[model samples]
Target: MTKPSSTDRPNPLQVACSSCNLRELCLPVGFSGSELERLDGMVATRRSVKRGDALFRSGDAFEAVYAVRTGFFKTQVSSEDGRDQVTGFQMAGELLGLDGIVSDHHTCDAVALEDSQVCVIPYAELEALSREFGELQRQFHKIMSREIVRDQGVMLLLGSMRAEERLAAFLLNLTQRLQARGFSPTSLVLRMTREEIGTYLGLKLETVSRCFSRFQEDGVLEVKLKHIRILDLAALRKMVNSPC
Candidate 1:
């Protein structure tokens, strides 16, 4: 048998929904082979965005949703005070542009945190396909439902959790999401800056730093700038679950 070379490996960009590694985490779930081919047709094209570039700015018309094929992104909303708040972070296999659907225009800015590639699922085509496929319709609704649930959890974190609890919960959530995407659950390279994280967690930058230092002193984790190595996942969990 001829030996397979690097060229033989599947190219992520060329792979269709039926063969994509992220199929389990994307829209391909619950779709049959024939359905997957049809689903692929809805993805009009692939787009590349450079770091620090806006995928879609607030007030831009919403035409499609994007599936992250590579790299990370952050969504933000600007306040009347001229301050910007980090709303969420997105990684490979996750969907973006949903915030635009309700109003027919993007409500926040989706910016690339790294050089990224996304599969563009044109909204009209996707809606038409969903109408023809009952399973697809249900799956799309389920995805939107999870997004709503995630937002509720964020509200709970901000309203009730203490600084440590909020930070811990944030780490735990990030770790779990990374794990789901086949990355290490206990280690991560933070894509957003500390200030952005503080904004999201409702803490000051110094407060976020203090929490990280305190966690390290307690042997819970090791932090070196953007890189983090979680040493005591159970301890972090306990901190998040403990009463304020």
Candidate 2:
């Protein structure tokens, strides 16, 4: 795991959650004016992480949760045999470090896929604020619930889906997330390498490459290195929904 350098430290500049454009998509969603002010006060700093640097690694003390302001990140864990398994990918407007809430220590490493910015919300202050504000507590609970559901979805994908189905599902999910962030739904530049994708999907690197090649041959996608364009969105969806 890459150690965080001095440059990765949180900047002292105050983050204004109320005025941040990502408010609707982040923790401040649906907050009243006064509530937003409280949140803005709680989120005191913004941190920048350069590509390939870890924001936090396994067993690190967890002081706060970070809300992604820009760029992407992947959460991974090292296996006993020294293999790293990609657990999940996070993008703008998503929260990281939630995995630490239970034990007060991170269980996985969060590495930036590109230069990224994040708003730091101190967990202690956030907890206090949530206790005082019912709406905030509800929103926080909802976010946690969403994470649980996502984990379950990943389990289903890995446990039952075929190689082609897993790849198609991954692309569809990635495009949908990008579309939610106002990017084109059918086209994307992959931030993680194919090997990383295979790690997350529980497939071999060679299998991942062959799956992409097959998709290209079937006119389901146009792939150029890291860039991918979905030529047959319906076909891809059918692959995911097709019988096991």
Candidate 3:
């Protein structure tokens, strides 16, 4: 078997270094050299998360917004039955917990689905930085816009898409997402559990299992336990883009 190629991620930012992928979206892209330096100094710390680890639980006190340095995570809210209802998934270079800043507390739990790193930037400090850096405010707005767009996409996907269509589209979305973060999209290990997936998709566990088997039997995808190989992306796209 061929081993995956390793990528040399540049040395992490001491304070918003050019090496950071999120600098473009998380910080002012057009900051004057001096302004950028000052803004960087306010950033305090970063934390690493392993698969199945919770970055913050629902109702945790909000301190700073977390920017993904690597890997993927999911956000979930507890349902009345004591089970979690998955609400969001984030990838490398994305921001998590931005919404919590407004309320001063977390509304959902943020859990890592794979080994991940996060850079925490204090909201109170950012308010001060935004005054000195006009572009920093713009970057904040850009991130907000992306959040709105993603939420809308999920609503549309869940309400209108068929079960099989939803499953394939979800895989395709995950594949393209991982690819953007420098991972192989075609054959990769599943990070999130099947139960998490079903909760996110609004499907029963048995239904999700059956959909996987049907996709495999029909040669659209190959599934062996948790590892998946997408054999027919074109067909999957057709399903996702199909008119319901």
Candidate 4:
């Protein structure tokens, strides 16, 4: 018997909403069994992206939304002055390209942080389907509302929070998200670079490094390269809540 080629290998991570554990955390929440089946049909194809590849570049034509099936991504925007800012990081089960729905063009670039797969859900078809399914319409509204709230939180972090407070809050937020996906709350890998973290937190790269070292000295967390271990989550929480 001939061995199968690499192209013929099956992907263990390629799964639809009906079989995905992340369904509860994604657009499929509150969807009935039949509704989930219908959603599966909307996902016409899954596209694989390599690390550092742009899933969709800024100002790209937006035809569909993507659901992360595996791996992580970072969305960023470039300023008029050529400075790029990290807007947000997306993980498995999250939706991307929603920023394009209103303007018909992507406002930010979505780059894969690792080899990833995303289910392509055509925006036009989704809109037509939502018109027929009230549950889906409501769920989509909730998803967009949640994104707004998340953006507001980022604003709060950058506008008023101190450097340490921002970092602590960021760690807590990451831990919460990973925990939701059945991952370890105290340990995880950072997909983005330190400079990216500093960019998102509105801090200098040196300051971000210093803050991490300070946290380690304070027993709040242990950071080695991109890996982080939460040594004292309560302490980190206290730092986030404490006034500067």
* Per-residue accuracy of model 2 over 82-127 as CA lDDT, tens digit each: 9988999999999999999989999999999999998888999989
> How many clashes does the backbone of model 1 have?
0
Model 1 stretches astray by more than 4 angstroms: 1-15
| Top lDDT prediction, candidate number | 2
- Better by TM-score, candidate 4 or 3: 4
Candidate 2 stretches greater than 4 Å from native:
1-14
Q: For residues 102-193, could you state the per-residue lDDT of candidate 3 as single tens digits?
A: 78999899999888878777888877877766778777887788789988888887898878887887898888877866678787777777
Poorest lDDT segment (10 consecutive residues) of candidate 3: 3-12
Tens-digit per-residue lDDT, 36-107, candidate 1: 888777775777788988889999999999989888999889988988878888888889999999999999
Better of 1 and 4 by TM-score: 4
The C-alpha RMSD in Å for every predicted model, in order, reads 6.3, 2.5, 6.3, 3.8
Can you rank all candidates by lDDT, best first? Answer: 2, 4, 1, 3
Cα misplacement distance, residue 41 of candidate 2 (Å): 0.2
Give every collision pair in model 3: none
Per-candidate TM equals: 0.92, 0.94, 0.84, 0.93
Q: What residue pairs are clashing in model 4? A: none
Cα lDDT, model 3, residue 199: 90
Better of 2 and 4 by lDDT: 2
